[model samples]
Target: MTSKVHLPYFDHLLELLKDQNQTAIAAFGRHVHWGYWEDPSSADGSIPDFANAAEQLSRRVCDAAKITDGLKILDCGCGFGGTIASLNERFSNLEMVGVNIDERQLERARSQVHPLNQNSISFVCADACNLPFEDNSFDVVLAVECIFHFPSRETFFKEARRVLKPGGYLAICDFVPLKFSLPFTHLIGKFLTTSVHNTYGTIKSNFSLSTYRQLAQKTGFITRIEEDITRNTLPTYPLVRKLFRENGAAETEKITAGAELVSKLGITRYLILSFEAIDP
Candidate 1:
């Protein structure tokens, strides 16, 4: 578990997210991960219900993690703590802790998430590579669209395993390349909604799904469920494309479009992977 993120892009991202940007925040209604569109028909619409779509995506991820009423969960790279907030409403008497390296996001998330949800809901400013909690502390560790932003996805995996109880789950939706190639691997990052359009941003990992599954296997976890929900989430790219253009990200707009085309051509694999940490 060595860090892969360094320098300008990660630094640039910190500054960009220090304060709430109206354009970016609008896409999430506070939850800013790439949304899941439950309605396949909405995938190609000129105007998709992004708020609804975003919530659906979170719920989908939540469902995969099997979030229960009383379980303790950690949302790694939890931005604005929106997922926790949503979960709080549905799952009562639960302890929800969201950890992120960004202070601004923590500040906003604290504002949005009430301290009392029949159980405490809190935010912590901590790195994903090294969590601030004791080992085996949580029932589940969730990363929705944010694992790729980690300094090392593998490190986060190891850390999540340490923090999670033996049967606890790690649920995530991450970008995976169809096949690893130097050219396509480099190009994939540009199309993502994670990075701000033209700025030098964090380098994203484009590991294939199999590579990740193998990593999970090596990490002492079993892949309980791994579904390619790519088609279900296709509405994200077009909306992101238009959002970039409207927000004056000319370069990112093209990249977003390019990413969309390849996705349609069946190259990009956005997966919902849930693994349960098991002791050997």
Candidate 2:
């Protein structure tokens, strides 16, 4: 039988891509968009008013965990610091730190975020599984839509437990693998449609809720909340297709192919899991 994965840090590779693509705008990876809500909810199937939707998602998360003012927060795998910026506003006294593997994203985060706020928010180039911080360093650790990329779920959970205080919480909102090795086209669609990429490997190892919960539990985190954001993201298909079409057929085909792959692979869901770290 095969053993569970335990990923190693690549010290040399880290320095090479440290400051590659720092943009002058916000951190949406591809675009400078703030919220991940380019939806089509109206009669003409126009994009949904996701500003409210995005805010609600962020607010719900903060409210659920009692994330208040003046807490030291860590955003693991924070892409472009969008979540960090949003949460910082929600909590006026929040000391926010965003860590991303992509140097380009961190650069853009540094440039776009306010200079005064810079003191409050620090963006660093670091790996999620291997964080550079003392134990019990944060009050709350938020991994919004960015943890699956970690080479090992076990390593991530261990690190999360290490850095968080005894009662500190870990909230993750990202894609969960339902099964291992999804169709390549579905994997490709996920990237093209969402403007996100897979730096780790193929779309295989996409896990289910139970898979994630088990890993979290194994790492000593007590699962507190788990919700599916799949339906919310799923219904936006028409709008995504339309946008792809406007971009042209070749692009649309690639996007649709990815979409179909997700459907065929019985992988049509996204997840958000929240847990509290147990002190030994």
> Against the true structure, whose lDDT is highest?
1
| Winning model by TM-score | 1
Q: Positional deviation of 211 in candidate 2, in angstroms?
A: 1.4
Shift of residue 41 alpha carbon in model 2, Å: 5.1
Measured against the true structure, the TM-scores of the candidates, in listed sequence, are: 0.85, 0.71
Off by over 4 Å in 2: 1-55, 61-64, 115-119, 177-205, 244-257, 260-266
Please list the C-alpha lDDT of all candidates, in the order they appear: 0.76, 0.60
Clashing pairs in 1: none
Residue-wise lDDT of candidate 2 within 1-280, one digit each (tens)? 1112221111211222344423211112322221233342432433344334445555555554558777888888776666776776555777888887777567767876652432388997888889998999898887765565677777888988999998888887766555543465355546553332322222233566777778877887889887765555553455445544553444434544565357445575566678898877
**Cα lDDT for residue 155, candidate 2:** 85
* Alpha-carbon lDDT of model 1: 0.76
Candidate 1, residue 54: the lDDT equals 79
Write the residue-wise lDDT of candidate 1 on 146-190 in tens digits: 887688888889999999999889999886777645366565544
